[model samples]
Target: MKQLYDQRISCPHCGHHIFVSLDASEGDQDYYEDCAACCNPIHLNMHIDYAINKLELRVDADDEQVF
Candidate 1:
């Protein structure tokens, strides 16, 4: 099945809303983005399965991993 999966994630640095898309065909399993409000880097850990059309998202850097 084909779908356009997306999620709204908040930036941990500035609490900004970010829109992320799940591109299974392009192998976009995991990625990161920047916060528009604070100009800080955001780390995104995503897992997408095309077969079941399931998407899991984890945003921001770890407590020990500084930006």
Candidate 2:
């Protein structure tokens, strides 16, 4: 039950907004994505709240949380 969706997120390194893939069915995950503007790896921490049908994401650069 892997549902993939494109989610817009800001790059921590360059502050550029980019769309990244998100898999809600994975429940929760931690991964990295390269920023389109800066080419820097951004750490993504995802949490799914099934009860509320919502997804919470934390984008980070160098282990520092951005949002």
On lDDT, the leading prediction is: 2
The numbered model that scores best in TM-score is: 2
What TM-score do all the candidates reach, one by one?
A: 0.67, 0.78
Model 1: per-residue lDDT, tens digit, 1-67?
4556677888898788878766656555566687777877888876666678766677865546558
Q: Over the full model, what C-alpha lDDT does candidate 1 score relative to the true structure?
A: 0.71
Q: Give one digit per residue, the lDDT tens place, for model 2 in 1-67.
A: 3478888989988899999889787679999889877899999999988788778899989764578
Q: How close is candidate 2 to the true structure, as a TM-score?
A: 0.78
Candidate 1: misplaced stretches above 4 Å? Answer: 50-52, 63-67
Model 2 residue runs over 4 Å out of place are 65-67
Report clash pairs, candidate 1: none
lDDT (CA) per prediction: 0.71, 0.86
